[model samples]
Every structure is written in structure tokens, then in C-alpha cells.
Target: MNPLLTASGLHVTFPGRRGGPSARAVDGVHLDIGAGEIVALVGESGCGKTTLARALLGLVRPTSGSVGFAGAPLSYASRDLKTYRRRVQLVLQDPSGSLNPRHTVYDAVAEGLRIHRYAGDERAAVAAALSRAGLRPPERFFLRYPHELSGGQRQRVVIAGALVLEPELLVADEPVASLDASVRGEILALLLRLRDELGLAALIVTHDLGLAWNIADRVAVMYLGRIVETGTVEEVLSAPRHPYTRALLSVLPESGAEPVVLAGEPPDPSRIPAGCRFHARCQVLASGEADRAGVSSACRTRDLPLLDGHGRAAACHVHGTP
Candidate 1:
């Protein structure tokens, strides 16, 4: 399938203060989001997941590498990139924090439409956008303020704002992380419904594997700024190959498995280990010898390349079959 957006060798680094070297946030990450597909990017906090999302949207200037939208290198100055922004919108996680306290809900959702100079009637566009976002009976929400709406309502307004642009892709950064668990499911369902109704392609950045399991068509597991594993939702959740991926999957509730709580925190980006970044906490490598099937030793001390195995690509040396 032809990709709607393709980013290759993406790298982002923040210069350390006091003349120290820069810290890598996104380290040569590559990703593709095809039309009408939902790809979930999952990882723990501080893993640079947000940075990657920003890079995709061109909000962050990558220290190195390029982003291509619809087969052309994205150029910030070009009308194409502006159009791209309109076509590829972002639905941020915190609606309460994201929305303007003073702006009426109608103004919030219509903001994008106004910015993009959408057709003849602005009010009609605003109403259409709000209706599509499930703020039904649009008039009810038009005069409502952010503080007046429920958490779910605020988020739906945010989604309505993004949808107003009629984007081809949506990058949602932990869209439901702050909501009550009860509302999380509703938000996910809303996104799924939008995808189906609008034929939207979405790249959902989240930490919860369970959420990915429920809504994503495919899952890409990220760790320390690089993607460690990727496959069909079933392949990844059912039998993750990378220790990090497996560990993440294990931690989800009722997975019928004990979470592998690898000891130690993720290494600082500037001080990443000599080999595989996860080696220090890798249980397979802690034994100091290759296990019976030669599966344990290399999860450490090797810069494992993502290779095809178990129907997807994984970066764990122990699990890459070929």
C-alpha cells in the first residue's frame, strides 16, 4: 500500500545546558502511516514518543533527516506544508489544558475552519464540525465554555477542532491519558468511529498496550527513542519478541502473565550504554550466558537491528529468527 506519510532517519536532539553535548530525543526513527490505517506508537514516559509525534507534524525541527508527505520532502515554507498541516491535524491529550478557557466551544472547534478559510459559511461549518465530533445538537455546545463541559465533552471538542480541517491523518498524543478510565473507552471509540466515518489514518501515541490492543490495527513498540518492535496487533500483543515489548505487554492487566519489571530506569539519552540500551535491565542477559536456545545473551551488548520475525520487525537479537 502506498504510504500517505513517510518519515525516515528522523533524529531530534536538545542541546544540553552549560556547553554540554546534546541529548538525543528521537534517534533515527522511521515510520509510515498509510491511508485509512491506525498505527499505535506505544512506550513508557520519557521515551521520546511525543518528540516523534511532533516531528511528524513538523512542529519540531528535526536536528537531522527528512519527512515526506505524499511523496515529497516536506517544506515548511511551501504552501504544500501548510496544506499538509491542514490535512494532517493533531488531537492533543489534555482537552482541559488544550482548550482556551475563555473561548466558547463553538469558537474552539471553528478555529481551524476559520484558519483554513473553509467555504462560504463559517457558522454552518462550525455546526457541521461540532455535530461530527458528537457534540450533537450543535447549538447546545456552541455557547458552552471549556470549564462548563465534562472532560469527555472537552476532548470531543478538541477532536471536533481537528476534524474541522478534514485531515487525512490524525496524530493523537495520549489522547485519553488524563481522562477517567470510564471516559477513556469512549474517547477511543470516538477516534475509531472517526476513522471509519472519515476514512482517517491515525497514529495514536500511547503508553497503554491494552488501549492499543483495543483500537489499533498495528502496534509499534518504542523504547529510548527508537522503535523496538512492530507487527499486527495480534502478533505483537499475543507474542511480542523484544524483551521490552514483551515486558510492556506483560504489564497490562489480566494478560494472564506476570509483568517483567526489568530493574533500573531507562538510561539517560546522552549516556546510553555501549551496546543495546536495554541491556542493563534485560533479564535474558542478566544470566551472563546464552540460554539453552541462544536466546538470552544477545539481548544485551548488541545494537540489535529491527529484522523480520514472527510476522513483523523486532530489534531483539534473541528473537530475530534470521
Candidate 2:
């Protein structure tokens, strides 16, 4: 199936401060989201998951590389950009911040239609969007203000705003990070429902591996601005191949394996390590096992490709080999 959104060799860099080196927030990421699919981009905070999501949404232009939507490369020219924006919506991490405090639920949901110059019945569109987002008897919430609703309801409003535009893809950055733990599952289930019922594809940026396990069809593990491993959720989560991926999974409460506590913080993106970016913190490189000499050398000096020639892919020299 053709991807609803595609990003290839996407790189985004920010200029340095005080003549220091530039920060490469996103580095050579290749990603795709098929129609009706939910792909989780998981990693530690500051690993560029949000930056990559912004690039995909065209909120930030890439320093290099291309992003294609529905087979056509994204065009930043004004008219094209406006059209693209309508089809690809963003749900930010904080609904409290994303929604206007002064705008009532009706106004918040209706704003997109007004901006897009939607010709349909504006009231009907807003009501339907709220309904789709799980705010049933949508009228009950129409006059409510952001502060008037609970955190979960506010998030549903944000989602409703996105749905109001009838977007084909949603780039949600930490959709549940700010909500109570009790409310997180409800929001996740709502997203899954939207996909199953409306065929909306989503790229969810989150650090929670457990969330990925719960809802993602595929999981892309990001480290230091690159995807180190990507595969079916079962394949990647059940049997992760990348050292970084394994380390992440090891900490999961249900893994029943001792947590593989990594050493050292992720290096500054401006001074990303050569070869394998994770080599500095890789357990295998420090183990000094006699049989792992070749793998260690490669991990320290050679940049391994993300693809491992199997259904699952990992950017590790030792991955998939005996």
C-alpha cells in the first residue's frame, strides 16, 4: 500500500548559539505511514521524535531531504502549503496550551472550518467532529470553555479540532503525556477508534514504550536523531534487535528481565559520535567478550545501515547475525 505520508533522508538543523556548532535535531530519518495505520515513534526525550514529526507536518522545513504525501512531494509554496495543512493535522502534547482558553468548545472546533473557508454547515461539522472525538451529545460540550472541561475532555476537544478539518493524517506529539494516568488509556483508545472507524493514519511521538506496545502497528525506535530500529510492534517489542531497543525494553515492568541501565547521557547532537551514534553507551561495545571483537570494532567505527535484510531492521553491526 502506498504511504499516506513519507519522509526520506529528512534532516533538520538549528544554527549554533554564540558561534558554537549547529544542532542536528533530526538526522537522515526515513519514515512512512500507511493509510489507516498507527506508527509510534518512541525514544527518550530530546531524541528528535518531535522534531521529525514537525518536519513531516511541514511546520518546520527540513534542512535537506524530502517529504512526500500521497505520492507527491510536499510543496511549501503558499497555496500548496495551505492545502497540505488541511489534510495533515497536528495534535500537540498539551491540550491546555493548544486550545484557546477564551474560545468555547464550539468556537475552538469551528475555527478550522472558518480558516479553511469550509462551505458545509459549520454547526454540523463541529458537532460531528466532537462526536467522532468521543464527546457524545456534542452539544453538551459546545458552550464549555477549556478551563470548564476536565483534562481528558480538553484533549478530546483538541482532537475534535483536528477532526473538524477532516484530515487524512495526524501527527500527535505526546498526546497523553500531560493527562492523568487514568485518562491516558481513554485517549489512546480514542485514537485507535478514529483509525479503525475513520481510516485516519497517525504518527504518534512519544517516549513511552508501553504506549507503543499498547496501540502501535509498528514501532520506530529513535536515538540521537535517527531511527535505530523499526518493525512490526510484535517483532520489535517482543524481540528487539538493536542494543538501544533492547535496553529500552528491558526497563519495561512486564519484560521480567533485569533493566539494562545505559551509561552516560546522549551526546550533544552537535557533536554526535562517529560510526554508531549509540556506541558510546552501548553495552556490547564495553562487554569485551572475546567472540564479539568484530562487532565491537564495527560498532565503534562503521556506521551500520538501518535495514538488516529481514522483516525487522536495526542499525547495529551485530544485529541478525550469529
Candidate 3:
């Protein structure tokens, strides 16, 4: 089956001053989210995860490439684009900030219906939205303020707001990052259930690989604004081939290693290095470059491309051969 959403060769950059270098926030990002599938975009902060999402939502226009929703190309002025927004909603990381403090839970959840002009009585729609979000006995939450509810409840209200529109796609950006660990699992489970029950295709942007391991059908590992690895959860997580992917997996706590220490920080978007952006921090265990760390010259000079292997693809010269 064709993907529900497809982003090909997406590139987004902010123009710098006449002489200054422009910032490359997203570079050649290609992704495909199938119907009813949950694809996780995992990366560190400032890695353009949010930028890619905004491009997908048409909130930010891409400098190059295309974003297709369903089967048609997504254009800013296209009628399909407007319908796509309603069919694809975003649940922000911070429910408190996303919802208006002054608006009661009912108003927040029903806002989508109000905007979309969904038929029937507003009150009935409001209560139904609450019920669907698991805020059962919907009456209780309808009258409650955002501050009056718990973190999980506030998030549910946010989800309900998105669901109220009956969207087929949901872009959840760091949905559980701010919540306490105890509640994070519950929220993640709720998101998963929504997909299973409502057939929602979700693009979950998160930094935690654990979250993706728990909920995603596929995982895409991004580094320096590019997708370094992509595959099913088992293929990418169990046997990640990219040096960056390996480094990330090495420090996963459960990777059974004594915390693997990575060298240097991620490259600045404005001054990205030539060739392989990750060369600055890589340590090819068997390549005799383990001691160089950030000081190594080989990493600073070489470029790697996503190579097919073991039922997945990873961009790392070291793992691509032998």
C-alpha cells in the first residue's frame, strides 16, 4: 500500500545575511508513514525534528522537495492542503501551553469542531470528544480548567481536541517529554490505542529511543538534520549500523555497556562541516581510529551515505563494508 504521508528530499534553510552562511535546519529528509503505522523520528534536541514536522504540516514551507499526503502532492494553496490539516492534527509537547488557560476543557476539545463546522449540537460533540479521549463521565472535565486537571488529563484534553476533528494523521511532538515518568507510559499507551482503534497514522517526534521501542512500528534515526538510519524497530534498534546510530544505541543504558562517551557536540547548522557531518564525533572501533575521538582527522574529512544492509539502511562508511 502507498504511504499515508510521504516527504521526499525535503530541505529547509533560513537565509543568512548577504555574506553570512545560512542555517540548514533540515537537509534531505525523506520519510514515509503508512496507514495505521506509527513512525518515530528520533534524534537529539536542535536536530530539526520539529522543523520537519512543521514542513509536513505546511506551517513552514520547504526550500526544496515535496510533501505528499495520502496520494496527492501537498501545496500551500491546494484545497487538499486545508483538508489535510483537518485530517492531520498536531498534539504539541506542552499541553498547558497549547491550551488556553481561560478555556475550559470542553471548549478546548470542541474548538476543532467549531472551526471545522462539524454538524450537530456543539454540546453533544464536546462530550463525545471527551469520552473518546478517555475523559469518561465527560461532564466532569467539561467544566474543569486546564490547571484543575493533572498533567495526563491536560494531555488527554489536547489529544481530544485533535481527535475531535476526526483526523487520520496525528503528529505528536515530544508528547510525553515533560510529563513525569510514571505518567509517560500511560500517555504513550493512550496514543497507541488511538492508532489501533481509530486507524490513525502517527508521526511521533521524540528524542528517547525507548519511547519508540515501546510504540513505533518503524524508527528513523536522525543526526545533523539528516536521516542516518531507517528500518523496522527490531532491525534498527537491535543492529544499528550507522556510527552515530551505534553511538546513540551504545549509551541506551540497556545496551549493557558502561555508558559510551561520544566525542564533541552536534555540528552547528549554520557551519555544518563538509563531507560527513558525523565524522567529527565518530570512533570506528575496528577502523583503528578509536583514539581520535573528536580530535580525529578522518571523521572530519569523510562523508557517508545511507547504505542498504540487513534489511535496513544506515549512513556510516565503517558499517557499510566488512
Candidate 4:
């Protein structure tokens, strides 16, 4: 199947303060989202998942590499970029912050339509989007403001805003990170329904592995600025091969394995260490498992190759297999 969106050898860099070295926020990431598919990009706070999402959406032009849509490389020209943004809408992390307090619920959801200069029945479009987002009898909430709604309702408004655009792909960054557990499930299920009903594909950026298990068809594990492992949800999460992935899962309540708390320095994009960016905090290397696998030296000295478009792959010397 052809991918609806693709990022190839993607890199995003931010200049450091006071003429310091540059920070590589996204380093050589290759990802794809098939039509109507859901892929989760999972990592810790500063591992560049958010930056990757922004780049994919054309909000931040990549420092290097390319983003493709529907088999063609993306063009950054103003008109072209606007069209891309319309086709690929973003659902941000914080609904409270994303919505304008001054705007009524109807205005909030209709904002996209107005911006895009929709010539169709604007009120009907807004009502349909709100209803699809589970805001039943949407007309009742039309005049309400963001502060008047619950956390979940605010999030629904945000989703409705994106849905109003009738986008083919939704790049949602931590869509449920701010909501309560019960509300989180509702949002995830809503996304699934949107996919089944509207044939929308999504690239959801989040730190929660459990969310990936519940919502994604495929999961990509990121560390520092790179995606170190990726595969089907069942393949990667069920039998994780990368130490970083294993460590993440170990911290979960249901994971019976001993906690694999990462030690040493947290990831720094400015000075990503030589060799495996994750080697310094990898429990597998610390446990002599890499040595037993006869790849300890390689793990500390050489960067693992970029993951291939294979069934399942890990970017670790000891676990570099598909």
C-alpha cells in the first residue's frame, strides 16, 4: 500500500545559544503512515518526537532530508505548504492552551473552515464535525466557551476543529496526555472511529507505551533524536528487542520484569555522544549482555545502521535484526 505520508532521512536542528554547537532535534528519522493507518511515535520528553511531528506537518522545515506525501516529495512553497497543512491537520498536546478562551465552541470548531475559505454550508460542517467528535446535539454547545467545558470536552473541541478540515491525516501530539484515564480512552476510541468512518490516517506522538498498545497499528521507539526500534504493535511491544524499549516497558505496572531505570546523563541533542546514542544508558550493555553477544565494543564505538523497511527492526548493535 502507498503511504499517505513519509519522512525520509529527516533531520531538524536548532541553533544553540551563544554560538554553541547545534542541537539535532530530529536525526535521520524514516517513518511512514499508510492510508487509514495509525502509527505512534513514543519516547521520553526530549527525545525529539514532538519535533519530528512538527516537521512532518510542515510547521518546521527539516534541516535535512525530505517529507513525502502520496509518493511525491513535499514542497515548502507558501501555497503548497498551506495545502499540505489543510490535508494534514495537527491536534496539539494541550487542549486548554490550543483553544482560544475568547472563542465560543462553535467559533473554535469553525475556525479551520473559515481559514480555509470553505464555500460549503459552514454551520452544517461545524455541526457535523462536533457530532462526529461525540459532542451530541452540537448546537447546544455552539455558544459555549472553552472554560465552560470539561477537560475531555475541550479536547473534543480541538479534535472537532481538526475534523472540520476533513483532513486525510491527523498528526496528534500527546492527544490524551492531559486528560484523565477514563477520558483518555474515549479520545482514543474516537480516533479509531474517525479512522474507520473518515478513512483518516494518524501519526500520534506520545510518551505512553500503553497508549500505543491501545491505539497504534505500529509503534516506533525513539531515543535521543533517533527511532531505535519499530514494528507492528504486537511484534515490538510483545517481544521488544532494543534495551531502550525493554527499559521503557519494564517501568510499566504490568511488566513483571525488574525495573530498568536508566542512569547517567539524560539525552542531549546538542552533544549526542558518539556511537550508539543510547549505549550510555542501555541496561543490556550494563548487564554484560552486549558483551555476551560479542557486540559490546561495537555498541560503544559504532552507530547502528538505520532501520530498514522490514517487518521488525532495532537500531542496536547487539539487537540489529529484523
Collision count for each candidate, in order: 0, 0, 1, 0
Sort the candidates on TM-score, descending order. Answer: 4, 2, 1, 3
Q: Considering only N, C-alpha and C atoms within 3 Å, which residue pairs clash in candidate 2?
A: none
Per-model root-mean-square deviation over C-alphas: 2.0, 1.7, 3.0, 1.1
Candidate 3 — worst ten consecutive residues by lDDT sum? 302-311
TM-score of 1: 0.94
Best by lDDT: 4
Question: On a 0 to 100 scale, what is the lDDT of residue 206 in model 4?
Answer: 93
Q: Order the numbered candidates by lDDT, best leading.
A: 4, 2, 1, 3
lDDT of 3 by residue, 188-236 (tens): 8898898888898999999998888999999988888888888999988
Of 1 and 4, the candidate ranking higher by TM-score: 4
lDDT of 4: 0.91
Q: Rate the local accuracy (lDDT) of all candidates.
A: 0.84, 0.89, 0.83, 0.91
Better of 1 and 3 by lDDT: 1
lDDT of 1 by residue, 28-71 (tens): 78788888889999999999999999999989989988888888
Models 1 onward score TM values of 0.94, 0.96, 0.92, 0.98
- lDDT (C-alpha) at residue 127 in model 2: 96
Task: State the lDDT of candidate 2 residue by residue for 1-322, as single tens digits.
Answer: 7778888888899998899999999988888889998999999988999889988988899999899999999999988999999999999999999998989999999999999999989999999999999999999999999999999999999999999999999989999999999999999999999999999999989998899999999999999989989899999999998888989999989999789999989999999987899989987777764135566666777776644212467887777333
